[model samples]
Target: MNKISYIRWFNEIGIDDVPLVGGKNASLGEMYQNLTAEGVRVPNGFAVTAEAYCSVLEYNNAWQSLHAALDGLDPDNIRDLQARGEKARAIVYGCQLPDDLQVEILQGYAQLKREYGETISLAVRSSATAEDSPEASFAGQNDTYLNIASDDALLDGYKRCLASNFTDRSIHYKYDNHFDYYKVYISVVVMKMVRSDIGASGVMFSLDTETGFKDVVFINAAHGLGENVVQGTIDPDSFYAHKPSFVMGYRAVLKRRLGSKEKKMIFTNTLNTGNIAVEYTKNIDTSSEERSHYCITDSDVMVLTDYAIKVENHYSNKAGSYKPMDMEWAKDGLDGQLYMVQARPETVSSQKKGNILEIYHLKERSVVLLRGRAVGTKIGAGKARIINDVKHLKDFQPGEVLVADTTTPDWEPVMKIAAAIVTSRGGRTCHAAIVSRELGIPAIVGTENTNEVIKNGQAITISCAEGETGTVYDGLLGFEIQQTDLSQLGHPKTKIMMNLGNPDQAFSFASLPLDGIGLARMEFIINPTPRESPRFSHGEESGKLVLT
Candidate 1:
């Protein structure tokens, strides 16, 4: 218990420990404490308390300097923001951990090493906490250091995480969210690393990412670490599992789409390798055979789906309402097992009331040029502007469709002006998809060949209205929009069988008068080709017809 001052094991803490350990660690702790008994695998870890962060800053007498550096900040001024952020971070990075804290940290590391092995690698994550701001609300507030193997490496990574609290992106996140800089404290969580580099990893959501549908669990998977999918570096293999059907012992995997997992991230043996600035991990190209094969099996997806549903239900019980979950999972190559790395309440879709229904109909169907994960529920048409690098961000015109390999929060300024976004990488939970959803801009993400196939300055239409898989049409075809207040609508009873094909229309039709679906032809509702759907794209049987 003497180590309580510096380290709190994940199993010992819960969601209520957010103030002390921060949301990320507290969530991991919550799952480890509650869900492991139910067979939801959470890797063991410990959190370096937020109090430790304050103690380190106070011990070095750097708090005043750090606060002063961020006094007159201008979030709009790019150069000024960068300078101040770097300066504030430098103050924290310059400070040393107190002797007692260092000893406590080493002790925690030693315990983990003893459990895993002498060469155990840990993922050092920075969890920022404050009174009003939930961790999910402010996306990417700090850096995560993965694959740390040594004592010095762990300590160094911890300090870097502390410093990341003042990163320019973190500053932007804080400024946007109106969080008091000093009030937020950063806790470093040193957790056991999953050997995903040798296997596969990806992200999961208890509900559909697009349209805020709650009947299905959406999963995006890829070879190597989950970062590739989260960062939109890879078009991860997509799967939709029907939660209701799964419970009834049916083939719950309603649909599956194999992704062109072009690259996989793996642990690097050497510290520094040429131009690559990353220390622990490196990205390498995947074989065509590897890309072609689905990394996870059907049984794997079902198990993951079952666990995801458990997480959502557990959280919903705690909140006294429905609470969807956004979780990260990894497959350990050595153990051949799946582990939930992290879990947080899905901030976006869960909050939506689905009160307003916008029904989009394409009057003319053109050649389907490209497809990816859909972000928004609407449609957008504009000229395609392919930007390869950040330097060319200035040249982008307003209302242009942003076609890129991927996007970060840094590209928000440009992304806002885009009529729609099309990325060659990333899944529905990625930065590009998340930002576009918040901004109300339609986006097609994880379209593997968008950068190559989509011509620059070409007129195109991006439509997420179809379903889960967004499509980029060859031309700006005519489309109609009908908005209805679903809250005021009444479902009149009648023995009428609805003829449905497109999954997008199913939601709008649900508000209408109808008896139970009479004949929902499996062939009609199911889009055999993966390109046809997003949230409801591969919906099988009557899963697509059921609302809520």
Candidate 2:
């Protein structure tokens, strides 16, 4: 058989091919290769390689033009940067796909049709080289076309994905991350669409996103397309499953939150102004009946939680270490089957030092100004800065609490500088909550009227240390931070094991007078350190020293 250049099937690739297929495709291929036989459902797909993307630009004579447009451009000058980015994208859009690449894509699609059927609708998604990495997640920074049914539309989607590499946000992200524009390349992932329009779709994390708690699987689900949940356009239903207890056949669903999912994105067939047939997503108002019901059932929740645990365990065993994953899942209402669309390494708390638990307590009683789902186990107090738009993000001073109606990826620049975040709309998996947790800042989301109730420049206390309900208090209420030493603690008859996840805290934890560490999350200690390697078999006793 001759070597194929343009496309690589999901079964033919793995995580090692990230340079060729990009992170998203690489992860999909990884799951398909390693977990499909284990009963995990991943939609069949093929990736247009980075080499194909480069060839397309070279064939269209746009490579030189794009580089020249980017030459000496000041990324800090927003207008100039946007203008250059637009010019580059225009060049990509103006060009046509090389005949060979087009033939390859069509051939790949035909193979899928042979397997799935002739009327199989596809999703074309952009997968940049640096996206979905453990260091930085460029989520929702590119384009994705769903329900593409024709050859022309598929080709067009490919071009759009290529052009999306020059989106203003993409350009700014590259500049902000110090990634060389020339080195970053784009790959297109063409996969069988999971018919999420007919059912439900959302995101799931193997570990608790809020507090870096390793014993739970956090899932967020909403009707129709999963983008709404990821983009923070709608609040979704939240589910938390206790992982430790789950293994013992206990359905430990710790909590469930029903969101006001007022809108849904459904795929529809329509004709363009030019009379061309196209498949697009239409935003329809969700009925009161739909809003009041859960998108998924209790059975589905258990299945999803089980899959999360299985995926984590599979990857952990493969890498000879623990691996917490961020995954996207969808249900096919037509067939009542669920599918895993994408999975990647969890970037946030997994990378942080988790030795110390900073417990916060309010020193004085105060009136609660607002309440919502808490995203951390700490307290923050600062002047509240109510920001309604991204244009005035710079006006927000550092150490001020960021109060917003909602937040998108654009608000990240100012969100990092905030001492805390309070949002009027969003769930635990929304952008505001996710970023706040990653930044180690306290956040209270889904307050519904936080922006209206909270005034600008008012001193307020944001407390997420109190269970699931986060509260915003009026004035600068006094608080105390108590750092408990892991080494020195009172002993009891029963074993008191420490939850030592970060390797940096291993030595300190080892000095503790407890029986032993209960869950030393392997991903945290995977990186090489000066000390000996830590190794433990499954189901080990508490007193046994696991660290080598």
Best by TM-score: 1
Q: lDDT of all predictions, in order shown?
A: 0.82, 0.83
| Residue lDDT tens for model 2, 322-353 | 78999999998778899999888888877865
Over 5-97, each residue of candidate 1 has an lDDT whose tens digit, in order, gives 788999789899889998888889999999999999988899999999998899999888987999888875667777898899899998988
Q: Model 1 lDDT vs. the true structure? A: 0.82
Model 2 lowest lDDT segment of ten: 502-511
Off by over 4 Å in 1: 1-4, 130-135, 273-278, 362-369, 382-385, 392-400, 451-460, 473-480, 495-497, 503-548
Q: Cα miss at 447, model 2 (Å)? A: 1.4
Could you tell me which 10 consecutive residues in candidate 1 have the lowest summed lDDT? 528-537
